[model samples]
Every structure is written in C-alpha cells, then in structure tokens.
Target: RDLNEYLFEPSKLVAKVTDIYLNFAEYDQFCSAVSNDGMSYNEQLFPQAIEVLERIRHPRERIDAFLKLGEHIKTIADQHKEDDVIYNDAPEEYIDQISSILMNDPVMLPSSRTILDRSTVIRLLLDNQIDPYTRDPLHMQ
Candidate 1:
C-alpha cells in the first residue's frame, strides 16, 4: 500500500528532508515529517535532525542544540568520561576553524558557551576537526 511504502522508506525521506534543510534551510520538513502520521520509521529522527540543523545558522540556536545533543550524548559519554568538560577540550588550532561561521553570523552562534572567537570555529572546519559540509543535524541530535 502507498501508506506502507511511505512508512518503510524512511531513509529516502530522510535524505530528501536533509537536502531541503541543508540547501534551502527550510523548516517545512518538520511539517511534512509530522504529516507522516508519526508511524513512519524516520518520523522522529527527521524532525529532530531539523531542530539540530536550524542551530547552525545562529549562535544562540547552535548552543541550545548542542546542549540538548550533549545531554543525549552524555548518556553514552558518561560511561567513559563523566566530567562535563571532557568533550569541551578543543585544541587551540581546532578552535580557529569555526570562526568564520561564528563571526559571519553572530545570531547563529549559541549563547551558552563562551563562544571562542570566530577564529576557533573556522579552524575547526578548516583543520578537519569539524566537517561542516558532511555534517548533518542528526549528528548533533
């Protein structure tokens, strides 16, 4: 049935959603995903990823997304490193990579973190610490 097909083909839908979110930076994907009736496999993951993706455009949003994600990742990380700052350690060089993303758009930056100079984000992206292109919102979520 067509409905079954929609529910089962979550991967394809996710790809489509990601393309729209990344290229156009639109939130309609959330609405469409919600239209899937909440029974689809990717239903939850798709919208959740969008929430994470939206943060990239603004600093404050980014912080909120990461903090939420960090909490989620913390469960697994706690098993290894219980301390909060364990993952916070970014080498000075790595810090420089994300700068462009930060300075270019202040609102896109998060409010929680100290927000190392824009240079830091730039370095992270340039040095390979952060893969800006390949990165998906789902990753942080």
Candidate 2:
C-alpha cells in the first residue's frame, strides 16, 4: 500500500508529521533516504508547514510552540556538538528578562520574562523591519 494513497486528510497528516518532526529532529535524515528525492515528506510539506506556522498569530502561543519545537532540535544539536567537541561551552540560562528600551515595557526574550525568541524577533525584523507587537522599529540591541 502506498503511503501517498492513504486515506488521510492533509491537515491531520500535516499535524501528525509536525508532531513527529518536532519530537524527533532526525526524522528528516532517515526519511530523506527513503524518498525518491533527497527530501523528506516534511520537506515536501514545507509550504503547508509555513502556512501552519504563520497562521499561529498570537505572539505568545507562536513563541511557545516554536520553543517546544526548538527543544527537540536543541537536543539533537547538543548531541552533535558533543560528538564534535568544537567548543566546550557551558550552558547558560535559556531565557533573559529585559525592559524593551524601545517600547519601555517589560518583556521576555527566549529564556526569561518574555516569550519572544530572539531569532524570531530578528527574523521578523529582517522580513518586515517592524516589531510585530508594538509596530515600532525592530532594533536589535
């Protein structure tokens, strides 16, 4: 039976794949090997995945979900770093609290008081040059 022919709704399939990919980052490597092209189903589903990620509009929920996904990637990345031993860097506190000097409001970044991931903020800044929340200048301090 062809997996592609399976009677599954695309949304359900995407959700299941998203969960699996989020839980196990290595799923891509293994899956890519099995596919005709050097890409996994997730890679094929990239457009849909972006849609799903973008549809999550709430900043807190979006950041939280991304962080949850990041945990899986971070675990795998940590193992590879250990194997390579490129840098014996100590783990620092994950989040940081800071008053947004621009907005003058308390906000958390990554590991602390605010939920926004620094990378996400940076990406948003790069893409739009404006803060998603306050619509102010997105400056990286």
Candidate 3:
C-alpha cells in the first residue's frame, strides 16, 4: 500500500488496491496509510483511499466521497493552472481544432467551448474579465 501510494497517481483503482493492502497488512503500515500527517506523503493519496473505502461503507457515504474526490481533483488542478499547462494527450485528430490560449496548443477548457491555452487566458483576464466567446464575466478569479 505504501509503495502504491508513492508510485501511482490517485485513481479509483489504485486507491482501492491501496486500501485493500493496507487493511491486509494490519500494522503500523495501516496507520501510516490513513494518517493525515507525513511530509513525504502525497496529501491527495489518503483522501482518495478513504473515498474508495467509503464506496463500501454505506449508501450516502458512497456517493459523497466519490463526488468529493472529483471536486478535490478539479480544485487542485485549477489552482495549478497558472503554474502548469495541462497537456492534452489525445490523438491529434481529437484536439486539432482546439487552439490553446498560450501557443495555440490544442487544449480545450472542460467547462466550456473555450479552446485557448493557460497563458492566453491569463493575458486576456488581465485586460478584460470576460470570456472571449460569450463575453460573460469570467468567474475564475
């Protein structure tokens, strides 16, 4: 479980496997897996593991944990948007029509039809707080 937590990116499959192994290990390692504090640990890993466990916990717990995981991942990604460009690994055909706001890279915004890259969005927001297409007030701030 510890190795999986360190190696794999947080996902439902990885999270579930880690949860199983940690419970199977049944020792300090299990404590380590669930503990919230550890400088070397990925903060997202524990919550992801807990959410995976919650799927079998109870009905309401099952629903909210997964939803919370999605929201958590999105929030973290949004926070990093300025510092990192989210790459689109889809085949060229899929993104060919999408123009990144930065170097016209092929990446589209998930929430809208906006296809601009991160840098372009920053520049545009600096000048005008409106979405390019709808002219709607950019609520990203």
The CA lDDT at 23 in model 1 is 42
Best by TM-score: 2
Clash tally, candidates in order: 25, 6, 3
lDDT for 72 in candidate 2 is 44
In model 2, which regions exceed 4 Å deviation? 1-7, 26-44, 53-141
Better model by TM-score, 1 or 3? 3
- Taking the tens digit of each residue's C-alpha lDDT, what string does model 3 give over 85-130? 4544444443423242224444444446656666556656698867
Which pairs clash in model 3? 100-117, 101-116, 101-117
Worst 10-residue lDDT window for candidate 2 reads 95-104
What local lDDT does model 2 show for residue 139?
A: 61
How do the residues 1-141 of candidate 1 rate in per-residue lDDT, one tens digit apiece?
686766775444544555544443334444333332335533345446555455444345543543444344334434333332553564543342443212322222232333445444444446654435444221111
How does model 3 fare in lDDT?
0.50
Better of 2 and 3 by TM-score: 2
How high is the lDDT of residue 54 in model 1? 55
- Candidate 2 per-residue lDDT over residues 1-141, each given as its tens digit: 665687755655555565555455456563322332224323334445646655643244543554545454445545554643633332323332232212213234422224454645655668876655556665666
